[model samples]
Target: MANPVQFLSQVRDQAAKITWPTRREVVTTTIMVFIMATLAAIFFFLVDIAIRTGLTWLLGSVS
Candidate 1:
């Protein structure tokens, strides 16, 4: 098992090996995530409306 100093040194070495995303990549992904989230919200809203309408019509017919 590594001692504390050796473990910290290993961690530092691993951190240095990380490849961070470019600004353009980060911006593009952020925009895509927002767009997808918006589309998903719209889809769920429409589905909820449809289900509610269906249930209302069915219950009304039973009465």
Candidate 2:
């Protein structure tokens, strides 16, 4: 097994290699996600309304 000190040093080295995203990138991506989610919700809402309307009309006519 490797020595604890050596392992910790290796871990530190690997951690330093990571490149985190910039603040601007994070903000832009967050905004895009919210916009896409809103669009999806709106689309589903419209589709649900249309289906409900159609079914109501069909059932109403048969009664």
lDDT leader: 1
lDDT of residue 17 for candidate 2: 100
Number of clashing pairs, model 1? 0
Task: State each model's CA lDDT, in order.
Answer: 1.00, 0.99
TM-score of model 2 vs. true structure: 0.83
What lDDT would candidate 1 get against the real structure? 1.00
Tell me the alpha-carbon RMSD of every candidate: 1.0, 1.4
For residues 1-63, could you state the per-residue lDDT of candidate 1 as single tens digits? 999999999999999999999999999999999999999999999999999999999999999
Clashing pairs in 2: none
Across 1-63, the per-residue lDDT of candidate 2 in tens digits comes to: 889999999999999999999999999999999999999999999999999999999999999
Clashes of each: 0, 0
Query: How do the predictions measure up, each by TM-score?
Result: 0.90, 0.83
Which predicted model would earn the best TM-score? Answer: 1
